[model samples]
Target: LAKEGEEGAVPGPDLVAAMAEQFAESANNVIIEEVNKGLNPGMIVLLVVATTLLLFFVGNYALYLYAQKTLPPKKKKPVSKKKLKREKLKQGVSAPGE
Candidate 1:
């Protein structure tokens, strides 16, 4: 039931649901239908390839994250004199001036 935005429209019949019902009622007792019930060679190969690639990428990313957490911190770089002087000035260590 569509709530009152009223293009004065009744809900249209769902064609997809109608099609699915028609297909489900199909009595196509073909021998090929029985073959599709089991996994095909192409589908098995695709599944194996997909699973392998997924594991490889996920394992690599997991190892990278593990290394990030477990590895020692990098050495600190030396601060430049300009930044140091600015910091000192901010801390009110001024030179002798008006």
Candidate 2:
């Protein structure tokens, strides 16, 4: 009876160790699978956003360059203080000092 009870008892240390190892392998596989599943899409989204921002800036810069090329050069009329005083005098305006 005693031998039969011992034989029918729970598994030994080796079986327990094997079971623990299998459980660890399964847990590792699950962790790896989850990380892979999450990482791929996350990286894709990040790349898309980064690419969009890069293209946006590049396109804006291109448009800026195009506008600069197409626009006419600005001409600034040079006016001296003497010219302004002469014009004011012509318009019958008094000078600063009486």
Candidate 3:
């Protein structure tokens, strides 16, 4: 079903943050329940480490993508005609147009 009016609008940062917090809380509760239900300690450690590394890599890649999109392109510094002419003159080379 489609949402109507303000309900269909994009969620702002505050709403997004709250939703994320709530989701995290629920995830934590689930983890805690699994621990209480005799989840292996080694399994928990592995899961934590794997999740951290995955998130780190994904976040790093996302930042690289954002930087690529928002940053300006590298510019080249061209040699000016005046500088080129001076260099040529210092080398005893005469200008063709002169």
Candidate 4:
């Protein structure tokens, strides 16, 4: 069945076929050119390095978070006598020296 358009005539099957063939030929040419050139080694190396660095950082960060969640809390260091006295004074307790 022939399609009717505002112009009173639609594109014939032969014309459509020819247009499709031309488009396919151009697309094939582009594909062939890309295949011939292949991938850029420099770009591939850069991508590999970037991906390695990204994964390394991500793995380290994930490990850090896991450690924070799973590891025991650190023991507090012993306070010096002077620091203890200062803390006591801050809490309104007089130092032993008066």
Candidate maximizing lDDT: 4
For model 4, the run of ten residues with the poorest summed lDDT: 28-37
Cα lDDT tens digits, model 4, 26-82, are 986764433567679998999999999999999999999999999999999999999
Off by over 4 Å in 4: 1-35, 89-92
Cα lDDT computed for each candidate against the true fold: 0.80, 0.85, 0.87, 0.90
Writing each residue's lDDT as its tens digit, candidate 3 over 38-85 gives: 778999999999999999999999999999999999999999999999
For 21-95, candidate 1 gives per-residue lDDT tens digits of 788778564456344568889999999999999999999999999999999999999998778778878899973
Q: What's model 1's overall lDDT?
A: 0.80
- Better structure of 1 and 2 per lDDT: 2
* Superior candidate under lDDT, 1 versus 4: 4
Worst-scoring 10-residue span by lDDT in model 3: 28-37
- Top TM-score model: 4
Candidate 1 backbone overlaps, count: 0
Evaluate model 2: give its lDDT: 0.85
Name the better of 1 and 2 by TM-score. 1
TM-score of 1: 0.44
Q: What is the C-alpha lDDT profile of model 2 across 1-98, one tens digit per residue?
A: 34424766777688889999999889867644334445588889999999999999999999999999999989899999899889889999986775
TM-scores for all candidates: the values are 0.44, 0.39, 0.41, 0.52
